[model samples]
Target: MQPTMEFLTSEEAIQVDAALLSSKEKFSTRLAIYALRCLKQIAAEKEISVEAVTAQQVSDWIKKDENIQQQLELDSNFELFFTRLVLSSLKPLKQIAQSEQQPIENLTLKQVVSWFEQESKIRQE
Candidate 1:
């Protein structure tokens, strides 16, 4: 298993938001929510704090290949579905985040909070 993160950066959250293709602002807000949930999952499984997520951890989570169609008795491959979604949605953020070369946990809290604050202002406008 890979190490996990405690939080999502603003850019990463945006990437997830874009991936969802949501039409409603409320739906788009789920990006941060889902990321935190994923971080919690990773933290629980790995016994790590959610604050120290790594690129590798996020990558590993995204690559899990859930295959939920098999679960629901459908003939479709949910694993492939998620794989494509991660590639299309996260690749750009992954690239950009890594280019900075700073620690993942280092910039996460303030940035995520700031992103939310900015969004809140926009929503209130």
Candidate 2:
């Protein structure tokens, strides 16, 4: 029989965020946000607090010292998935910029999202 996974509570999840924030890895703000989103999803599935999965832990498992080429080789789908997530997350930010009458080129949010999309496409090949 398979063992059931144990879940952490909400309080525990907050701890995870702290751990992630303390990691040496210099995750881009958007990447960090994506990681947090993934952590929350994982936590929900496991019925645990998001805190149980620290940023450091995620950094260790997924981000630390890993080359993009290596990651693409490991999972061809990763680039696509990451790009989609980034683009989706950026939509609202883009809308906000537009609403504020800000120039899209000057918007960090738009630039980052465009960068992710372009990088993803290049990596996928």
Q: Model 2, poorest ten-residue lDDT window?
A: 20-29
**Tens-digit per-residue lDDT, 1-125, candidate 1:** 52343234566556545542334543433444445556656767887765565556755785562533233244345445543443342332233235445533233433444444455566667
Which pairs clash (backbone N, Cα, C closer than 3 Å) in model 2? 8-48, 8-49, 12-51, 13-50, 13-51, 16-51, 20-55, 20-56
Tens digits of lDDT, candidate 2, 4-31: 3223334433443344232322134345
Q: Judged by lDDT, which candidate is best?
A: 1
Checking candidate 1 for backbone clashes, the offending pairs are 4-53, 5-50, 5-53, 6-50, 6-51, 67-79
Best by TM-score: 1
Give Cα-based local distance difference scores for all models: 0.47, 0.44
